[model samples]
Target: MNITESIKFNKLKEENEALKEQLEMAHYFNQNLGKELDKLKQQILYKEDFDVLAEMYYDYCLKDNSKYDKLLSKEGE
Candidate 1:
C-alpha cells in the first residue's frame, strides 16, 4: 500500500478501536445502573414504614429532572 493509503487505514482503525472502547464502557455503565436500580427497588420493598418509604421516594424523584437533563445533553453530543 502507498503511504497515503496506509495513513487512512491507520486512522480508520484507530477510530474503530475508540468506538469499541466507548461501547464497552457504555455497556458496563448500563449494567451497573441496572443493578443499582434493582437494589433500590428491593430497599423500598423491604421498608416496613410507609411514611419513610414515601419520603425516600419523593426525595429520589427530585433528582429525576437533573438526570434527564444530563441524558439529553449526552445524547445531543
Candidate 2:
C-alpha cells in the first residue's frame, strides 16, 4: 500500500479496536445493572410484605384506619 493508504488503514484499525473495547465495557455494565435490578426487585418485595403486615397491625391491633386511609390516598396521588 502507498504511505497514505497505510496511514488510513492504521487509523481505521485503531478505531475498530476502540469500538471493540467500548462494546465489551457496555456488556459488563449491562450485566452489573441486571444484577442490581434483581436486588432492587427483591427489596421491593420485602418492602411490600412489610407494608402489608404493618397495615394489618394498624387495622386490627390499633383499631385505627387513618394510616390505611392515608396509604390509599397516597396511592391515588
Candidate 3:
C-alpha cells in the first residue's frame, strides 16, 4: 500500500480500538450503576418514607416481585 494509505489505516485502527475501549468502559460503568441503584433502592425501601416505598413497589411490580402482593395481603390480614 502507499504511505498515505498505511497512515490512514493505522489511524482507523487506533480509532476503532479507542472506540472499543470506550464501549467496554461504558458497559462496565452502566453495570455498576445498575448495582448501585439496586442497593440504593433497597436502602430506600428500608429507610425512606411510604411514598418512596410506593414508587419502589411500582417499580417492583414491573419486575413482578411477588413479595409486594404478599406484603399487601398480610397488611390486610
Candidate 4:
C-alpha cells in the first residue's frame, strides 16, 4: 500500500473503534431508560389503586388507635 493509504487506513480504524464505543454506551443508556420508563408507566396505570389501598390502611390504623384510646380512658375510671 502507498504511504498515504496506510495513514488513511489507520485513521479510519481509530474512528471505527471510537464509534463502536459510543454505540455500546448508547445501548446501555437505552436499557436503563427503558426500565425507568416501565416503572413510570406502572405508576401511572396503578396510581389510583395504590392510593385507595393506602387510604384503607390509614383508616384502619386510625380506628384501631382510637379503640386503644378508649381503653386507656376507661382504665382511669
Among all candidates shown, the one with the greatest lDDT? 2
RMSD of each: 12.6, 5.2, 11.4, 12.9
lDDT of each: 0.69, 0.73, 0.70, 0.70
Error of 1 at 43 (Å): 1.6
In model 4, which runs have C-alpha deviations exceeding 4 angstroms? 45-77
Ordering by lDDT: 2, 4, 3, 1
lDDT digits (tens) for residues 1-77 of candidate 2: 99999999999999999999999999999999999999975553333444678787876454675554443322333
TM for every model, in the order presented, reads: 0.55, 0.60, 0.55, 0.57
- In candidate 1, which residue pairs get closer than 3 Å at backbone N, Cα or C atoms, i.e. clash? none
* Per-residue lDDT of candidate 1, residues 28-76 (tens digit): 9999999999998656422234346667787654435453333222223
Going through the candidates in order, what is the number of backbone clashes in each? 0, 0, 0, 0
Clashes of 3: 0
- Give the per-residue lDDT digits (tens) of candidate 4, residues 5-65: 9999999999999999999999999999999999976554333454567787876433354
Ten contiguous residues with the weakest lDDT in model 3: 68-77
Better of 3 and 4 by TM-score: 4
Q: Candidate 1: minimum summed lDDT over ten consecutive residues — where?
A: 68-77
Model 2: residues >4 Å from true position, as ranges?
46-77
